[model samples]
Target chain A: MAAVGTPLNRTLVRVRKPFSEDRTTAVVATTLSVLALTYPLIDRALNLGALDDLFPIVVYILLALGLNIVVGFAGLLDLGYAAFFAIGAYTVAILTSPSSPVASWLPFELNFWAALILAFFTAAIFGVILGAPTLRLRGDYLAIVTLGFGEIVPIVFRNAVGLTKGDQGLNAIAQPNIFGYELNSSTLWGWWYLLMLVGLLIIFMARRLRDSRLGRAWMAMREDEIAAASMGIDLVKTKLFAFALGASFSGLAGVLFASRYSFANPSQFEFSTSVLLLSMVILGGLGNIWGVIVGGLLLGVFDRILSARATGWIQGLGDATGIELLEKVNLRDSRVGFFGLTLVLMMLLRPEGLLPNAQRKRELEAQATPEGEVRVDETLYDKRGEPL
Target chain B: MQDLIQALLTGLALGSVFALIALGYTLVYGIIELINFAHGDLFMLTSFAALTVLEAFAIGRGSPLGTKVGALFLALLVAMLFGAVVNVLIERLAYRRLRNAPRLTPLISAIGMSFILIQIGQYWKGSRPLDVPRVINRLDLLGPLDIGVRFFLRDLILILVTIPILLGLLYVVNRTRIGKAMRATAQDRDASALMGIDINRTIAFAFLLGGALAGAAGVMYGQYTLTTDYQRGFETGLKAFTAAVLGGIGNLNGAVLGGLLIGIIQAMSERFLQNGSAWANAVIFAILITILVFRPSGLLGEQTPDKA
Candidate 1:
């Protein structure tokens, strides 16, 4: 930052690399998208049960991709991301569900289509509200404040039985409509397809932003806020945008989640869920979008499908080996421990994260000396009560 | 006046407990600038450790006063030692290598450590809240004549256990060589190393002392609340952390002040206001956010330009 020439360029451009450099990457991405799109159709034809499982994981990947913008690109550690997710879902529920007071109070309740648009903006507004007060604090302080915000939102929702219906939660969310046609809810492929398209578009937009001046400003702030500020980067605007955009993505996923489940409950979005999303981004590799997608997919599948199957496998092993310990221990029950371990091991072994961005990798691995020391003059305020 | 006085005393009792844990957070943060996220969980484990030791000794209210106090003393000592060792182990295993790498690395690892300790607590004790063994009797110490409120022996005992530890922490920090090394390192690690201070050892000792404080707090917490759960650390530790920040993180006396103030506020809110029980955390957090936004330095914290 002190030196003005060639500010280290790290683009979130993994998907768009020339075919010559990464033929496999492009091909695999194409094949995956095509497969993801067509899988539900195949599920319909074969009557497969596994396709139903993809819904949650796909939505989570979308969430992780959104979070990646904040933690990965902007270097803001948002411990309370589930707050935005909650905001999104609750917005949709209140707007669309007939039982909701808002719906009845209005001349007519908005449809699912209208609520989705409202959810995005409402989540973004909440994102700003949460982000505004916290911009000046450093990493851990920012994190803790976000954590508090995260805790407060759900608690408020839970307590406000008058508004949120308390623990009963809002139910009977209408099946989503698409261009005047009612989509089939029993067969979830249509929703899955919609979510997949949204995820792809966000990822694409994120990639473009990575190369844009605003993304560079974010990188500047993330790399060193003081230096970035010295270089005239608007720290407030950049951080807020990161929070706003990151939150909007989570809101998108929340709407999808509420619609599909036909219910919006506070319990569904909790600290553990936030931790799960964060682990996905951190383990996948911070700052690398493709890596985040990979991280989300691996962990999602593990958490959803493999973890349950692993429990059975552990039981089978115990039965075969006659080891009482394996039978006594349940991996699913201990999955939180697994997540905790993953975070610690990942940070220790590779602080750069799994599949780190090229620039983020260089910076993390570079043993970059601590940014120019904070001095008395640079302190936010002074003893005489004058601002520094 | 009666309600106010009652709230005041209750807040102070709770504050003393918070002060102990907040001291640990301040100590670690002052030296390493790493918020030991696991400190709260470490305190949780120490309570379980104390319980297991007490169980092994079969000491209870039924025993003679000396044996009862002695067994409880022994358990406290064991918990202190266990907490100190485990804290150092966390530092040595997870943090020592990342000393110079990056700030975020150790922090992420610390979070990971918190989760691990929480799970261990869950597995050791069941997930449900366990009723803490009443080692200390619950007779009201402050009167036959009700002053419109009761200050139980439990509150007095809480003060008895906590105050001495606070005094000891002050003595160690103000008077001892390890304490001096810690101060020097906190001021400037590289400079302290140049001046022949064993920086690593100093940092390790900081964790040890921090762990000891956390362990001591854990026992008091269990005794005061009469229940322990795995998630106890998440709530208590977070409150303590808020205290540390409120007191001006890295400022020793500030932590004590912050803890007392927070304890009082929580007590007052819980007792005096409608729906205060549910709103206490939200209110406290609102204060935290307000402080960070309006006055990041906190009530007693000085602007330390030299430190990161």
Candidate 2:
């Protein structure tokens, strides 16, 4: 039976590879770069303010990439990635605040570049602190513990009245400046577009890392920890690196976020934010860099479009119908309902995601059974073909 | 000394509620190895049910003691039924289909379910805290050493009532045929199924039992706290989950111990942390980190065969 299935399975696998060369990677990168460069121009020409919409997408893309390193490559489930984002935002807030000492020491002022670098280190340090004890545990345990950390961080920031101003939030955070030219001009789209360029650079680096020895080791650990360890992978060091590197991306995104908003609040770093970011990674397809980018863009665009128009759309429908019941529908609150529904639908229909990672696509396809039968039986078989 | 005693008592009372909630987590996890994140929301719903029922009766309108007691029992039964139904529905809709999906999928579904419950409650209750009626009379007692223990008669009664009931639960789980089947399913679902156990039904029963316990805890919590809100479940759920982890995820006895420990720690941390009691979460998480570092499997959690 096994011999009979081998040729058919190989044929099926062969038909699935769409773009299979360095040429494809080059084409993707070039197209993305061209699009990134022309985005602001397109926004201005179309009079659509697309740059404003694209800003958060860029942030999310960076974040999803960061999370991809840990959750995707390293197979570490981190539900608290927002804590690192918070660290980045807070670091910039504290250092660049008018009352802070860093303001006096800097030649010009605390700007985006400095903040971005500092945010990386600050968030990375916290990542190390969180990872030190919990990294030894298995996946689910790490997820729960990280969740605890995520919940606690925001609450601590909110309640530490003396330091964090107890929910009023830190405001008037300094914006980015290039050389002597201030990037804080009304045309903030320029700075955001530049950030997207920087995001592309980070993506490039990530792609490189994905194909590197460290990336291979992380993937090996994710697939089989004992096997990876036996093959001379230092579990502690590799896990910490994954955590630290993953955190650094969020940290970078955070600094950019504070600069973009010119404000930082504890409320912004809630579990929902973490979930949203996780959704992006999952939606794109875990462990796939390109998938993460696509997922981020899709989620960011969807959220923006829905939030801006959902209320109006509902009100318009109410007006058209002349029904008072429809008028009372608060689309803002309904957004969460939609989010829940989307998550459930996506998990059920597209568990491997819209753009699954290469390995995940293969695995999901292999485990895909007929619609009625439970998929567990195929996946549950041990080495001896007996159920555990 | 007086403050310490009061804090300890307060902690114990609070811990009892946590223990009750934690039992739901432990029980569900034991059977299915899945954390029912929506359990806290179910608890919140139960509290709302109790509040609504109590308010319906003239108990809030100064009805007599007998009327109030009758209302409370009726509310408890209704809430328990609601919990059981909700659990069954959740199993059928969200968890049943994902039985073989990656672990993360079910967990995420649980989170999604939690948001749905919270949103539905918010929509129903209008996002404000519902005031629980002050129907139970307070009774103070002084012990032998002039201990001056001011125990609320209602709370004391609840603790006394819950203890035997939980013990009865323990007895059922350990001594009954159904209980043996439950354990067998937990140990090996396939093996249990081979031996003629209906795996899905057993899991549903586990969820129903867990939800019922959570329902009871919700009513008790509402009575103690004097208010119930949609957002209450998130924090309460986190704390209970932490307790379940501390005691051992799948161990009933561990959950009880963990809950009490967390309650006491939370109370003491609030008392001692000088910056206006806001460091409660920080302290609790610190304790959690310490425990995870020292004992990742938790105090009573036995090592299971690695499925991952």
Candidate 3:
């Protein structure tokens, strides 16, 4: 596509040399982002009020960024991550919702912005509390405990009828008012702009964290915990940081989610929610920041927006074509099955995921050959609760 | 005292079902050390298998007692066979490749398999728990004793299924050549291989036996609870795994003991505490965390170093 010997082409190539060895891909990505940002504006201007659909996608991506820190970077598989998200949402709901038990008990209502900030710390503290004990446990045991926590937390929230209103959930959660100007969920542009701003900030933070010293420590810890510990990486502190920091972002995402939907329910925070988040991290390719984005967006959009519509579209096509099979198939019930299939297929076929981490890629390559002929590998936890 | 007796009986029934499932976990963990996450779902699916078999025979409450019992025995056989095959297939297909990879890879794969199994259960059985038509007469077997405690045919069903299966498993593990091979392989895989034992075959055998027991537990579980659901596995599986760990993960007898203890605790907690069944799962899980914290080796666990 480059015009050979053209002056403009030579100038563009010279300008792009510092960014990367290849420039077209970067240029395309940049152009796409710019276009994406403007499309919302265009939609608004054209009287289309569909900007609210993006709120969930943006919020989920934020949560993915948080989970990526713990699972992707620290190498801890947190199966109960949605508990933190639940805590975040529930914390906001309890504090700000007029019908909430806390509101009735406390006799004082907290502002949305204040509650939003508080939710982050609240969720982070919960993460640290969970991480403190379970992080000491490794591999499968750790995973099981987290899974238990994930189940137990939602059940507690659901059963604590006096506070969470049982299964009915909290409604009319206070929406955020920045500088006395109310942010409305119906006004698509305001919500979209705010979501995008938070999205960019978290993205920037994730990129920075990836390159920082903590990131290296996480990598070292993930690769070989004994080696990292011997290297004086302060394993406990490093891990807690990963858990707390990861949880903090999930809290923010929850605030946005609650404010947009204006509801918080115990049913929203199930064990499957944690699984969905974990799948996103794995699907994106562990240890790669950009891949998490791609994975989260791919999953979030498909699950939230496209799944039912696509199924209906196919059904419509079948009805038109008089094909009996396609019209009767319900995609909703098979969502979890699809998730399960995705996990199995991805692990077996592409464990490195859509984006591959260089070190992990190397690790996968090394494992490509047979490690042994016919002997069992130590796949169980030893006395120290570490995988042998 | 009467409540205690009733709870005691209930505990035994629950414990027996748990023991059967826990045996599968312990056997596989003993041999391969991989936590088969899908084991629970596999167990759950076995109920559906049993359901399908019963339906095929048109076995329902109206069926004569003789026919009902016969049909159930046949269904249990089919369920066990299906469980064994599914467990073996999962290992061969999903886990065999990552046998030597870092421990997490296979664990995730197992989790994936579990999700698929759970979803399949939902699809097969629908999202809700299905009522198992009570073919077994729920006549109180011990009502004549008049000790103020009632025991039904359903409670006795646990014993009928568990005792035979447990005895059969003990015979197989203690007396069979494959059992010896499994023991040798668990002790030292490399040396076992050097001694001409087929490691993969031994491991697959362990999975088959484990899966069969889990399948048996599913049938027993359905009969005792009088309901079977797609999601039943997660709850039962969690408790059974806890039982496995509590009893010392690799120890066969330990799993049984642990299962009994958890069953007693569940029944006692639900009985003695006011409205306790709602908090039963949380209580059991709490015990698991406490046990893991204080005694990671579990009650009867022997601290064996890496088998390599």
TM-score of chain B of each: 0.96, 0.94, 0.96
Question: Which regions of candidate 2 fall more than 4 Å away from where they truly are?
Answer: A1-35, A100-111, A365-388, B142-149
Taking the candidates in order, what DockQ does each have? 0.48, 0.45, 0.54
Best by lDDT: 1
lDDT of 3 by residue, B1-308 (tens): 88988888899889999999999999998888888889999999998998888777787767887889888898889999999999999999999888876677888888889989998898787888788767678788777987888888887877877888888888888899988999999887889999999999999999999999988888888888878989889889989999999999989999999999999999999998766887888888888877766676788998655322
Candidate 1 lDDT, A272-353, residue by residue in tens: 8888898899998898777788788888888888888888999899989999998876767776777789899998898766
For model 1, state the Cα shift of residue A298 in Å: 1.3
lDDT of 2 at B15: 83
Ranking by DockQ: 3, 1, 2
> Runs in model 3 with CA error above 4 Å?
A1-32, A42-50, A367-388, B304-308
The DockQ-based CAPRI class assigned to model 2 is acceptable
Q: How much lDDT does each candidate structure score?
A: 0.83, 0.78, 0.82
My TM-score estimates for the predictions, one after another, are 0.92, 0.90, 0.91
